[model samples]
Target: MSMQLNYNWLLVLLSYAVSVLGSFTALQLAVAIPLAATQRQKTAAVVMAGGAMGLGAIWAMHFIAMLACDNGMDVSYDASLTALSALVAFAACVAGLMLVGSGRFDWLRLLAAGICMGLGVAAMHYIGMAAMMMPAKISYASGLVALSVVIAMVASTVALWLAFNLRGPLQMIGSALVMGVAVCGMHYTGMAAASFEDNGGQLPDGYAEGLRGGNLGLTIFVVVTILLVLMLVLHYWRQRYRSSISI
Candidate 1:
């Protein structure tokens, strides 16, 4: 039973690691360059734009990642369902945008963003699951799994955002990486929580084993090392090639 629980934990961590590494890296690539391009005078605009770009990129990455994984399979799931979900999310976002722009205390904006994220992540996973579903009948277990994923993602976002804000901007960049991992971790944890049977089949296990066997630890080490080296080399190259912008 303990072993089963451990395995379930492992599954969550593994899934989170995938999101952090894949989606986060994509986020950096998507947002960082644009931020660098903007001058200090336009800092606020750049910052906001960078954020919008980051979230947009994350969504794009999630969709494409699932679609890529779905390759050649019969994704006979209803296109309208996915479309409607996206439309609702868009409308919600628009409303949030208006609320924020209207200059009220904007409590609603935050709530809306949270709801948008939860639904967006949930819809993506459900649609992906639908695409991946075998002809076997759907069950309540599936709905629970979906709920778990959504809750985990929303929790992760809150956690990561808190962690990021606690740190300053320089640290915020690193926090974003942490946030990425948290997002992915939460997502997969949710996936793992899904009970396949009414009685709840043996709880999952394997945090350590999954870390090693799943190759997540190795992948993180390799990727982070490479990215660090790349960053160092780029830092030096930039110093040699371009004058630093004076604040």
Candidate 2:
């Protein structure tokens, strides 16, 4: 029989909040890339934006959502895979942001970047799911899996376009809202694609040693706190930049 899966609604809301905040910070960081006067400045912007999107928005939100899941079974995650998944997400966001942030914007670059990010996000989610060490086997519905990927690509492209093309308050809030949709949509859809079947208590090796929910909770808290700081810093920096140019 499949486990009776449920969720902590508060955590689900928090997951979305984290996604939005990460998206907001990343989108704001990316908007400044075009105005960067040198290669070094552009590179710095890309890295910061990528980190905000990948680590804060995608990776951290994923773990929070995972922790929110109440599967009625004790679960742990493989340390290496968990780390690898974050790396993949970070690298992908960096590459994608770099591609679109540099040079003149075009459909081709947008498409390519979207595909890269979309695949990366999907890959991270699946890889994270694989990190689970529990007494159950998980399978996915092929169609829903594919649908989730499509949503990731489309939403990412739209968000990036909004960030690059728009100005004023709309740019930051709009792009971030869409990006939040991209992250949250892909996550929950991928989760919906999953079906967990009960196993004969054949837990994975080292399950006892794997990272547990309590560990992840603390990590998520730290990530959220850092994200908040980044947002404040970004806002302060933007204000300074605007004042300098206005004078």
Cα RMSD to the true fold for all candidates: 10.3, 2.0
- Compose the digit string of candidate 1's lDDT tens values, residues 1-247: 1111123344334434444443333333323222344444234332332233233323332333333322222223344544454354334333333332333334454455556555555655555444323223223356667666566446434532332234244554555566655555444544454333222332223222211123433444345435534543553465456555542
Per-candidate local distance difference test: 0.39, 0.84
Q: Lowest summed-lDDT stretch of 10 residues in model 2?
A: 213-222
**Could you tally the backbone clashes for each prediction?**
13, 0
The parts of candidate 2 lying over 4 Å away from their true place are: 238-246
TM-score of 1: 0.43
lDDT of 1 at 115: 61
TM-score of each: 0.43, 0.92
Worst 10 residues of 1 by lDDT: 203-212
